[model samples]
Target: MSETVRIDSWLWATRFFKTRSLAKAAIEGGKVQIDGSKAKPSKNVQPGQTIAITKGTEHFEVIVEGLSSKRGPASVAQTLYQETEQSRSRREQSSEQRKLARAAAAAPDHKPSKKERRDIQRFKRDNLE
Candidate 1:
């Protein structure tokens, strides 16, 4: 309904962040950018404007398609922004790479067994002066 909405509020409304405070924090921490430059939480967002959001290892580049101040359902929120094809592909690639990395860096399940622990201790003792 509004012609322009606050970036932080829009982010939460669009479900980009779980809370408005987190959106504000992200804006302040340089995780959200407008037109390739950092913007404040209170910055007004307009339709057709591009925004870059970074969450964890995924970076999203989206064009604001609508503006709203109230949080809405996921389906409705998704209409607020249009993610570019490149951004989508990049995100998918990043996700795949993360999966592969996780698989490669997999750790043993649970803690070491008592026998394994004793073996580790013995190995350490043998190596130490």
Candidate 2:
């Protein structure tokens, strides 16, 4: 609970990342930003500052509420930042879209015919060699 903490350390402590190394990698990869700009792992974060993070297909924007450099329980980690309403809604909408897309991409109701199956096997065999 020291006042001075690196952005990567805070990110790991707050449960945003499972490890400090992951947090640092994210920062270096430009997946994490502070106040709308890319942030370095060595940067210091304080209350009232905005942070944006991209992890896989999800995006999060949060305002810092407190600081902690030690990982803690989920409840305590949640208190370290407050997610914005817009960010929440956008995440939900994107998830819903992905669900719809996945549903539309469902496998065919019937299995391939014997000749079609042979073609599929041939394609795989040719490509996987």
Candidate 3:
């Protein structure tokens, strides 16, 4: 058998996605690329190749370091690739932003009355539309 594997399989086996279908969806959505080119779920992947994947505001650049046909523990899965420094920095920044957002949301100490709460809900619904 060939040492290379399907892109979707590799993504799942390496724990980039929760399932094969999700990995396929990411690939089809252009969120995953190989060597800077958008890749398909059926694309063949080999060891030592680089892949870029974007999830929300986070981008990951990983170089394939090993091959596996099965899903494994996080530690084992992590050994399959090496993430680039840029990717790490981006992840840290995204995390910090999320933390700040959470802190801001929880910072308000005043509790709203029932009427105030209803008005706030109405405002949110109106703004959403």
Candidate 4:
């Protein structure tokens, strides 16, 4: 409801993180930036400010739209920021790449038996030698 909110609180309120501590960690870990520079958890976020956040393999760039110190529902949280078109496209591309990679590395239906494990180990040992 105020004109500005702390970055960590804003991130949590926007649902970018599950809790304020996580948001603070991300900010401190250099995973969150404002404009083009690193940001601290205490940074104040105002409308129209750009924020870049990296979470694991995903990246997001958003423009702040509203401010709220309290965590809200997804619908309300979404209204807090607008994701950049380029960021959305890049995120989708990366997501597709991850899906493809996962499909290619499909897990076996069953675990290897003792003999199979030994054979695999033996093959590796032979190759190493």
Candidate 5:
């Protein structure tokens, strides 16, 4: 409820990161940007400013709507920022691509059977010879 709040504190309060320390780490690692430029964890966040956050393969762009330094419930936290439509669509596309890639790269739950291994070895041996 202060006039200004630190970026990391706001991020944690908004539920972007599980802990303030993790938020600080991400900020230090250049994973969070404020108004299109890298920002420090201690940087102040004001309402109406835009922030870009990269968490793993997902990217979120949000405009600050409110500021709070204490963590709140999910519903309350979500109200802290407004996500742009473009950013939402991009995140959906990225998630779909990641799902497809993971499906394609999936291996069997169990190792290959002895017969299958033998066949593979035979094929390799024949090709090498």
Candidate 6:
């Protein structure tokens, strides 16, 4: 017989989410789905199932490969599933984009001039109208 585990417990055990409660919350919030259908925290999960989880700006697509009832080390947790190639590529691309955006937004060594500050204030004030 194939092994099955609760969705929340599996998520927590695999380290896809930090805590079981958080995993439950995400499931309740509709941030986690199984086979393209929304699932409850108590839903049974088995190997060969596809799970999609959304957290903040990232979405993960994973295929369950194993089942575990206990949370374990990172290496052990990593064996629970395989991340989809598209998901991995998207995550890397998004990370690179965020890094570029952050670098662009960070002011080098120079402080804003008085005129620049006034312009910013004026722009904000104009937008508030």
Which candidate number maximizes TM-score?
4
TM-score, one value per model: 0.87, 0.85, 0.82, 0.92, 0.84, 0.86
lDDT tens digits, residues 1-129, model 6? 777999999999999789999999999999999999999998999999999999999999999999997999999999999999999999999999999999989775787799998998999999999
Q: Which residue runs does candidate 1 get wrong by more than 4 Å?
A: 106-111, 122-129
76-101 per-residue lDDT for model 5 (tens digits): 99999999999999999988998999
Writing each residue's lDDT as its tens digit, candidate 3 over 8-118 gives: 999999998999999999999999999989899989999889999987777899999998869999999999999999889989998999999998887566789999999
lDDT of 1 by residue, 1-129 (tens): 658999999999999999999999999999999998889988999998999999988899999999889998999999999999999999999899989999999898899999999999999999995
Error of model 4, residue 22, in angstroms: 0.7
What's the CA error at residue 40 for candidate 2, in Å?
A: 0.9
Q: How far out, in Å, is residue 112 in model 1? A: 3.8
Worst 10-residue stretch by lDDT in candidate 1?
1-10
Clashing pairs in 6: none
Off by over 4 Å in 3: 115-129
Best by lDDT: 5
Model 1 error, position 127 (Å): 6.5
**Candidate 2: RMSD to truth:** 3.5
Backbone clashes for every candidate come to 0, 0, 0, 0, 0, 0
> In model 5, which residue pairs have backbone atoms overlapping below 3 Å?
none
Worst 10 residues of 5 by lDDT: 103-112
RMSD values for the candidates in order, in angstroms, are: 2.7, 3.5, 3.3, 1.9, 3.1, 2.2
Please provide, for model 2 over 26-88, each residue's C-alpha lDDT reduced to its tens digit, 9 standing for 90 to 100. Answer: 999999999999999999998989999999999999999999999999999999999999999
Model 2 misses residue 56 by how many Å? 1.2
Model 3 alpha-carbon miss at residue 125, Å: 11
